[model samples]
Target: MRTVPVAEAKAHFSELLKAVEAGEEIVITRRGRAVARLCSQRPLTAAEVLAPLWHEPLDIEAPEDRAPEPVAEWDD
Candidate 1:
């Protein structure tokens, strides 16, 4: 965790966000008093961001079986 004056926070806002993304917590202070806290809004791994965790199995009914018939040549 880190404490920074409001002015500094404002000046380095981008850097602050980058730090937060890197897992660093930040405290914004005003007049030496804690006013706000900053942390990663959403932390996710690459796999999580890429796809859903659960996928429903596909449902396909099998075709009905039929009795085999002799070939037409058998009649000849």
Candidate 2:
């Protein structure tokens, strides 16, 4: 973790982002008081990304009840 004044933080914003990307936490202070923090976000896994989609039911219409059409087999 690192602490920097607001003015310095603004001046070296890009460098601070680089540090944050490298998993460093930064605290920004204004007039000697802590104001903001910078940190990298953890990447979501495949299951975590799909969790929301699983929560809601999809609004898809069911196919009509009838005999299914046969798919033609293709010859190589």
Candidate 3:
């Protein structure tokens, strides 16, 4: 990830577009606070979004069951 000040990004808009096309993410900031990002595209699914940094084991243990809590009714 890379950061570019808002003014710099505005002045070098073409360069920023090229960087984004080359798969380099850029964050635009205003007053030292991040305001936007330049990236390829959005993930299609929740799994896609989480897949890059998460892993699942093929075999896993099941948790023990606990007693169910009683349901309560609410009245207005």
For model 2 the local lDDT of residue 73 reads: 100
Ordered list by lDDT, greatest first: 2, 1, 3
Question: Which candidate leads the pack in TM-score?
Answer: 2
TM-score of each: 0.54, 0.55, 0.54
Residue-wise C-alpha lDDT for candidate 1, range 1-76, written one tens digit per residue? 7999999999999999999887777999999999999987887567544445447644679999999987765554
Per-prediction CA RMSD (Å): 15.0, 11.1, 5.3
Residue pairs clashing in model 3 are none
lDDT of each: 0.85, 0.86, 0.82
Evaluation by lDDT, superior candidate among 1 and 2: 2
* Model 1 misplaced stretches (Cα beyond 4 Å): 43-76
- Model 1 TM-score is 0.54
lDDT of 1 at 17: 94
- For model 2 the local lDDT of residue 32 reads 95
| Superposed model 3: Cα runs more than 4 Å off | 42-76
